[model samples]
Target: MKQLLLIIMLFLISVAAYAQKVYSVDYQNQADVKVFVVKYENQADLKVYKVKYENQAGDNNGKWFFTDYSNQAKKKIYFVDYENQADLKIYFVEYENQAGWSKMSKKQLMY
Candidate 1:
């Protein structure tokens, strides 16, 4: 029972650490990740869905909750004007189910 409880606790902690609670920073230098919004879905590395609540945020799976304050966020991101300048290129999806990393190679950037 102690081992089971420890495993469960570790799982929860890992999930919380990976939560996609993001804040948009005013400057590129202030950001943890530099992102670009792609015009087309095919051009994107990740498809994002903005959640209304922070609890609805995914584990680096593109379901993002935009935090009002930078301190409240798990990741601070800057929206880059050009795709070439971005570390990650994303497309906003209409549905939550559509949110996920398209290019698996770039998945580590979220972590």
Candidate 2:
């Protein structure tokens, strides 16, 4: 009975861990995180690279695989009209090797 309970608990934990749902709000006030896309990698607080597969996505790392549907996304992001409205500013990098958070303080925004 204890083993069965432990297995069930583990399953619940795993499910919760994968429950990264992302929604893009039309307004900045409705968003949990504000984002900015920098024109250059050097100007970014976090350098991001889009992955081809969801399995390749990392924790608070710039490896993002955009889901075809919003429901399937782990992190919902809304692109604000202005830089000041964003909570987390990101720059898309050309190379996967360049993907990462330059400012560690903003790392929690992704997770």
Candidate 3:
């Protein structure tokens, strides 16, 4: 009976592990800066990552991602999805006067 319970627990754990969704930022093709809107499978938190990319070194660049429940200005990535191919891929750029983070539309994306 104990062995059967252990088997059931292991099965449940594996199922949970299989449920995660992940996306890759096309850094090579992104704007100078890219905002990646990552939605978690848990639905408990919504995140917008601000990424600053450069064409200089191969590995390091000035990428940044920030979010606050502060106000509605940061709602650009509120509805992004990884599974849907139509959804925006993660990347960053500079906004108009805002000067810090910018959301790139599907057309503006480098890739």
Candidate 4:
């Protein structure tokens, strides 16, 4: 029974760890994180990949699953017009395997 309980707790922890559901808000004030899309990957703080399914979302490692509703998302983000105005700068990657944090110091912004 103790092993079963441990297994259940571990499963729940893993699920919570990977929940990177995000929503794009229209206004900067409505966002949890202000994002700027960098043209070059080298310029980005994080390399993001848009995952089609919510289950495929990464554990704050840049695999983002966009939710249809803001309430359903873990984080609400706004895209800034300029890099200087942003709290986090990201580059969209072409492949899932390429998605991850380039600068670890900026990682807490997503959380």
lDDT per residue, candidate 1, 3-103, as tens digits?
A: 99999999988767647989999999999999999999999999999999877888889999999999888889999999899999999999999999999
lDDT by residue for model 4 (62-82), tens: 999999999888899999999
Question: For candidate 1, which ten residues in a row score worst on lDDT?
Answer: 12-21
Q: What Cα-based lDDT does every candidate model obtain?
A: 0.92, 0.73, 0.31, 0.91
Model 2 is weakest, by summed lDDT over 10 consecutive residues, at 14-23
lDDT of 3 by residue, 19-85 (tens): 2112233342432323334343232111222333211111112122322322211112322234343
Candidate numbers, best TM-score first, in rank order = 1, 4, 2, 3
Tell how far residue 84 is off in model 4, in angstroms.
0.6
TM-score for each of the candidates = 0.88, 0.73, 0.23, 0.86
Per-prediction tally of clashes:
0, 4, 10, 0
Clashing pairs in 1: none
* lDDT (C-alpha) at residue 11 in model 3: 84
List candidate 1 stretches off by more than 4 Å: 1-18
Query: Which regions of candidate 4 fall more than 4 Å away from where they truly are?
Result: 1-18
TM-score of model number 1: 0.88
Best candidate (score: lDDT): 1
**Candidates sorted by lDDT, descending order?**
1, 4, 2, 3
Q: Residue-wise lDDT of candidate 2 within 1-111, one digit each (tens)?
A: 999999999987664444344556566565667888877777678888877777767555677776676667656788877777777788987788988988888877877
